[model samples]
Target: MTAIKAADSTDQAGVWITLRESSVPVRAILAGVLVNQLGGFLQIFLVLFLTERGFSAVQAGLALGCYGAGSFAGVLVGGAFSDRLGPRSAAFASMAGFAGLLIAVLYLRDFPLLLTAITLAGLVGRFYRPAAAALLSELTPQHRQVMIFAVYRLAINLGTTAAPLLGTLLISVSYELLFWVDAITALTYGVIALLTLPKQAKRPARPDAAGRRAGGYRAVLVDRRYVLFLLATFVQCCVYIQYVSTLPLAMKAAGLAMLWYSVAISLNGFIVITSELLVTKITQRLPIKLIVVVGFALLALGQLMYALPWGVGVFLVGTMIWTIAEIAAGPTMFSYPGRVAPDALRGRYIASQQTMFNLGAAVGPVVGVAVFRAVGAQLWLWCALATMLGLGLALLGMQEPDTALARRAAAATPVELTKDPA
Candidate 1:
């Protein structure tokens, strides 16, 4: 089959064809990320690791918070690095840096030392994301954008689904073994980035403006619409993260067994892996805003399902609803910022999205758990309401990629240098 035709890609076969026809570099990214995420057990185990080492629950949680803080800041730094050093180098650096830190973290004994190391580990670990994502965006043709990201998300979900198992098995034996394995996979990706990504992966650090000019993130921040979209994204992430933290608490509080909670999570992961790409085959054809809005709506509805009488049936069914929402909307959410960004600013744009996700993740547990403690299951209702606001923001914020930027870029007249000559 030739490269996938946009019109023809509505079918499942066309989806496979698209994957087959993707450039080798793109495939390399998918492979590397799969390997990297396979050992991404650190996030799944950090709290456990700390607690086992005799840290108080509050201290463990604080260490986790430090990790989140590092990751939150890392994306912005990574975005800048990707623009300056190119995606391949940025990715390699992040992987290599993270690989070193992953093992280094195992040696620290004192709580203060552990906190500092974990924070750096988190920062360095996340540094590759913007570069990797920006590279993918550049490599992919816009028409195939969402589909490719769906495949990308599939790679992630596939690894994420299994990482916990590997983590569980290894943690049973030794944290040392788990940490070692995780480090190896990260280093492997660094090698892959260097070997697979050709020199063409470098984008101009400075993208020229046809009519007017701005600098660094100032160019990105001036666009009110994009900022609004980010606000919407931040809200959506807070609600989505509830499934990870608060949902379990709610399950336990409501006199439900943890088995049902685990099953519901596993179900979501399995369905997302199996069906996200298939769903994207259709969703990719829909308007970006429409898909995002529908996703938020469905997510809200899923939370409402939890608000119903708590039971195994409710748990399974609610998970299914949100799983559908994720498959349908997630690729578009991840891909849209890159699509709308100016090429030079692509890294920053994607980094911005990642930052929101991290920020939401950090805040979600704190806020969701607090609310859950206060009003109990009523937290679900609040999340649903917040989601509506996100939906509204998304509907308002999404617009066509500005044609003027491209037109100006093509004209190739250097009008102004908004940045300093360093």
Candidate 2:
């Protein structure tokens, strides 16, 4: 049994190694994910960015909420765009539009214009999400979906980890430079998508006995188990986002410098980027329910640690604890959408879950900051409680992954790669 387990591990590791080399679109998406995420400076710095410009904390929170709201709406529209326009056009539109609008926001000194630009930037920014996710899902087989999403998240974590430190350096020269770099990188990804992705992935779907499409948002909404999973996911994301939204504010309040917050969050990115793939390989071998429960619990526990004190020690240690939760559960959480959705509506399902993530992002800061003002550091306890609530829902709502059906669907559709112009 030991030998068999070790052999299984080797095969799993090998699969990830070959993933980047497997296909053109996969490689393009991976590169784009990394580049875009690395330059994803605006979201990380928006709160501070606005505060430095003399916007009140509440205003910054509202702007952050707008970004999240834009992302939420963008995902829904992105699903349709992904289906109708194909991955290439959808990604191009998202990236290119986001880049242009982002630059416009940086120039506008008027608060209302700034707020409007932020909202538009957020809206256009996430348009390619469903397309990229659908593309990855189409390329990967069912059993390996977790592995693919792990790689997908690796790009995101690596980029995010670097972004904070990188943004700090850019701001040393000019704050505008940071936004410019972000816009430029976004455009780079857009160009890559236009050149590499298939013109469209949408095609006719086979109707079921009901003479209607097999999947839609309506279908997703009616599914109780999945809806429950999304609810839990929202809370889990709320807990996770606190590190970004509230942690910095708390640290600043405690008289700790931004450097400390940067180091703490950078540590999280480093740990996840360095270890998540290995963690996923092992976790995928475990039962889904066990990981979900422990992961959510640890998330709450980590935040609970923050109730101790606001020193660097508490911050870093707490960050590490929740980062473990992320490693343990990230792959399952990401790939679960692909596992259950019908091929026709896969993008919509991915968007549905992602909307929950955005909902958490949208709501977390506004609520967190208000609570932080009301109760001070006791806010950490509230974060812990919220996570536990999510855990209970996850326990009841999430079901076994439909690996057989996913495997069968993946086999039935072989995606043809788009040839680059000579």
Candidate 3:
């Protein structure tokens, strides 16, 4: 057992060293994403802020729903922009726009105005993701995609782990300051994109392009497998979003303190940071479809864990379970669109997935809160069932990437081989 443990440690060290060899732009993008995420105050504080200002729970849910709606639209638009204007331009625009909108949010006191501001903020904030993903795909070779994305996820988790603690500190001083800090970080990311990212070279137009107009999103829509994958992703997202949308309110209703909820969230982030990279390394040889199916299963079980009658200890366990699901699923999920997409339509493919995921997020809060009010803690059981359905969908729909690639290569191979004439 001791020898086995030593071998495992050696393998982890090798993976760590491999990830450390990523290029300059990759490192810069990761740093920018980390800094930007650290200042993500909206998800953590937005609901609490609304409730403190005397808004009803339903109203806060609606506001977040609007944000999700805007996010859906933004990702679709951003994908097109990434293709047309290039990834760097798309990312810069998104981050800069997000910063401006966040500042606008700070001054808006009316519910309608605040709602509008938040929606716009979500729109601009979300645009960065598809653009960044597309950029990474462009820069990295196909074989390195999983490891690179794992590094990206690590950066995001690290930032997320710090965000709550930072929010806690900033909110104690003034909520307004939280808005300012968030905006500044976004602006900083924009600057990084502008200064460090190279301009994308223009793609020469295809000779038959004028005759063949049904490309990009139109082409992506016709891919039945990808569509099914999107359906599975939507369901998974809806189930996962409950933690942010309804869990806090549920805890409050159960007479639990806010401190406990914060601790649970922080714990979730910490688990991701500490374990994801190593776990990802170990799982790299596993079938991608199996990994995703298992992730969905874990998600279902985690949700059910919340339905148990125990206290914060049980909740923490649930958090850790879902965190493991996230670590298992996230890099594979991000890599799939890139793997399947044609070079010209990669942005649109990613955007389509993001749009579906965001739509689920938009709907999750409203549904979760309503169900929670109606069924109390039993809401979690229903969510678990929903996630189980998602798992089934994934198993049915997701193809192994290696199998697909092998088929493609086989189709392209010449029917006969001949020796060179001398």
Candidate 4:
């Protein structure tokens, strides 16, 4: 039995090792993503910075909300750019624009100018994802798409883990230094992209291939099943954001120390980094619909855990449960749009998905805090119900990924111009 278990573990380890040996462009993109996340301190610190500068809590909250709204807009604009200009140009522009806007934010103290700077910064900053996602899809084989996205999530988790500590140290030195350091990170990513990523000619106008449409955002909007998927995604995301927004407050209300809350967050990140890839590998062969359903079910279960009697053990258990849900759902969720989208409409599809995520993120804190305050601990039960609803919609509305429609769309995709440099 011991030898059997050991062999299983070894096989799992080998899966990760093979995943790490992806092509050069994929690796480069992952590295840039990691570096970008390491300096992603502005969103974390913006509220505190504004409050420290004598703004009221309400004012600071409004600004942060504006930033989220900007991110939503950015995703839409970025997706359009990715579809029209190609991923390389969109990425370069996002990073460079983000750096410049961050600098503008550093110097501006007045409320109006500062708001504009941060909003534009968010707009530019978010452009990277659709472009990056499109590029990765273009570069990777279909069978490997989920695993590659798992690596992308791992990079984000690892960088997020390191960011808070680094941001804390820099803020102690000076808040201005924090902005400058973040700007430098964006600039660095821009430079790396310019030097390493391949350039492609603009996508030439072509008639809609069989099984695909040629129109831009309009095509994405009109897909009835895809729109249903987006709605489910939005609700799940809203439930997910409660972890950062109201879960801590709920814990505090339940008499748990702030330390326990921090520990829960750390555990969440650690679990994602350690388990996401392995879980993705193990579950990659499952139907996408099944994986997503299981994920949402886990999310519902985790939220229900919060409604149990208050205890440190229960809190940690809840955190682990939802962390697993996040791991199970994330790669598959992000990769689905890429897989099913018409090749011509890939960027817009991805962007539309991201827009739903951002919208949920922006609205979550407000709704979470409001519900928690009004209903006290019972808020979690409602959250669980929401997840179950989302799960039901996903089961009903999501199409089978291997259906003829999907296969035809995949076949219709044009050959990518850039050759594998591996």
Candidate 5:
């Protein structure tokens, strides 16, 4: 009995090690980081770019919203393609389409053309995400999937972290040059993706497998579980978007230094990177739903604190608290839908969720500005805090999915897992 027990423990250790060593997920994540970094640099100046082109505040917002609309569309399109043609082909197509749009932007001066270019570029550019998620899902195992996803998220933020400083220096040169540089990077990404990503794996047909169309975006939209997941996800986004859209403006209004504003946002990303590993460890002992609820509670408290009469020091303290919650909630929320999705439809389900996220992104700025104007920034923060708390309470009773369900769904037939692409 003692020898048998030793053999079982040894086998489990070997399996865990092998899961960690899988290279395919790592490569997909790396490629995604490279592309996102280049795009993020361009994004750092997106509003300024529009203003330079003579767009009014409303127009600029509309253009940005249009970009989000395109992103929403792109997820559906890319997810469908990923299911049919596989991740490699879908990712290549998304990149190529995005590159063409970027080139078109250079020649367009008309507002309509500019709007169209922005929309098209956003739609095509972000299409890589869903396909990339699908690819990562295929390569990653069930138990460690959240950790891999967290690492991918970290990569995205890390890539973007340097963008602001780079943009500030380059704006002195030419914003037009910025556009050209972004375009070049995007094209290069496509070329690398075409050259480096392996062909999709092929497997024998499974008895329970369903058609790709059955896993379409519309199907996922109507599912109650998916809808509930979307609600929780939207609240998370509402809290996070405050950092970019409102928090900076609020700080400036209070006469705080720009350096502190930068510090707050930078520290938020830093916290995320540091806490991701810690969060993964906790997920093993605590239910994911419970962790999610705690995350939301912390987020609410942080936002509410900001609304109070705090000095610059206290404001920074609140910012740190918010950062902690953001770090904990961000990856888990992103990973939740994938865990709940049907195996064959996981890509489509994820894309549908992405579409909802883009929807929130589109609405966040307009709604935030309106809230600030109508009731003051304090009210805006309080309302957001209340919403987060409300969401936490609503989600308190929801059950977490079991490990078997998540793994089986991830490994199901749409993904023909054969060799490690890493």
Candidate 6:
């Protein structure tokens, strides 16, 4: 369970045991991911269900907004709780609540009731993400942080890929059946997490300096380096939303079918997983910021291709290009924040990032849809391109952390604090 072994984890030839590492940190990450992905399918279909039940687009947006707002609340609350009580307890509580809410969704059909249920579900489910993220950060050695988070992201996308398709098949039979399936998976994950996560996992102690900021959102904001990364991520999320929010309508206008659109999204997730694996192989040698900029450039190029008057073939090309970019950039983005976070406030730092991520996720759809509605398809791709370019330029302005900082931090950390139990 040493850092070296964690870093050198392997599976049988052609099989990556990304989840089966000896480290408890990796195990906990894998477990959390399983839970997140299993229940996450429920999120994708909420809007569709609302629309089917006679809610307007605006109402559906509002309901989702409420869900995001609820998640925001959970991030703050969970950040504090995870920082105080450790990620294991925080995750267990969050999963239990998520399962409870999913079960409640079955009995509630009215808009108000459903909205309330979704909000609660978001609240409960979101609490675990930051906690799990912080836990991974705590467990991983400096050199392997990016790979760890990359693997974590890969697990999430894998779960997302499987769950929605499963829900879709169930939906073909009955939405009620889909709900039941989601509930069962969620509950199962809750039980698994409770059983597998180490009982003794505890929050690390704060750095001693009474005057220094120790925990919470305020502490995270005070770190100018983290703030810069946060700003960069904000812009990235703003632009990334088009894939889900505006891309479908634009493709439809250009004669692509909804089936292809779904294919593109799945492809995007697949490419993201692949890119993360590639990035993990080279991250020690390459600068992560440079890698992320490369990703942004790819995304921008894809958007530009979409802006052109080409047909379905070009559309597929654009999606493939952006898919690679997503894979390259997404894992490093989260991994970097975890690396920079102080051990004591890791929960808060991770939560703040997720908070911003969710905030942008909520705002991106609203803005992308609003812009698409007002201007039409011609402007959509251009806007996405512009956003990507802006983020790339912004990335250039920030200072990149070198191996020295990571080494210094690792040297300073107490061995008893981070060692694996035999």
Q: Which ten residues in a row have the lowest lDDT in candidate 6?
A: 10-19
TM-score of 2: 0.78
lDDT (10s digit) by residue, model 2, range 1-422: 44345335634543456584567888899899999998888888999989998999999999998887787799998887776567788899999999998898788889889999999888888888888998888776655777888888888877876788898999999889999999999999999998888776646665766535535687778667789989998888877888878999988888898999999987887888888888887776666678898799889989998888647788889889999999999888998887777667778888888889878886888889899999999999999989989999998887556533555468657799999999
Tens digits of per-residue lDDT, candidate 5, 223-277, equal 6655777766665666657777877777787789989898887777777766765
Give per-model TM-scores: 0.86, 0.78, 0.78, 0.86, 0.79, 0.79
Checking candidate 5 for backbone clashes, the offending pairs are: 24-422, 343-409
CA-lDDT, candidates in order = 0.84, 0.83, 0.80, 0.83, 0.67, 0.71
* Cα error of candidate 6 at position 337, Å: 1.4
Local accuracy of candidate 6 as per-residue lDDT tens digits, 1-422: 24334334632111154334437656756765865686576668877877777779898888877777787889878887787777877878887888788778767768788889989888887787877788787776555666667778778877876777777888899877877777777666666667766553444554467424534677777666677667767777777777888889888988878998888877777667666677556553356557767778887777777777777777788889877777677667777766766666778878877877877887887888887788776565656666665575547534434443575478666788677798
Q: RMSD, model 4, all Cα superposed?
A: 7.4
Clashes of 2: 1
Worst 10 residues of 3 by lDDT: 5-14
What TM-score does prediction 4 earn? 0.86
Q: Give per-model CA RMSD.
A: 5.7, 8.4, 5.9, 7.4, 7.8, 7.1
Encode model 4's per-residue lDDT on 386-406: one tens digit a residue: 998888777776754446255
- The list of candidate 5 runs beyond 4 A from truth reads 1-20, 46-65, 109-111, 168-177, 196-198, 201-214, 249-259, 278-285, 377-385, 388-399, 403-422
lDDT string, candidate 3, 1-422, tens digits: 44334334433333456557656666678889899999988877888888887889998999888876787788998898887778789889999999998888777778899999999888888888887888776676555676677888887777877899999999999988998999999999988988877787235466266425766688777767778888989999998999898989877876799999999888887777877777877665456777887798889889988888788877889988998999888888877787766666778888998888878887888999999989999999999899888877777767665555566468546699687897
Query: How many clashes in each candidate?
Result: 1, 1, 0, 0, 2, 0
Query: Per-residue CA lDDT of candidate 1, range 1-422, in tens?
Result: 12224335644334678788789888999899899889897778998998888888999899888887888888999998887678888888999999888887888888888888889988988888898888888888776778889888888888987899889999889999999999999999999999988654545554447323575677678777788899899999999999999998878877899998999998998888888888987887766667887899899999889888757677689889988998889999988887888777788889988888878877888999999999988899999999999998888877544343555456555577699888
Ranking by TM-score: 1, 4, 6, 5, 3, 2
Task: Flag the better candidate by lDDT, 1 or 5.
Answer: 1
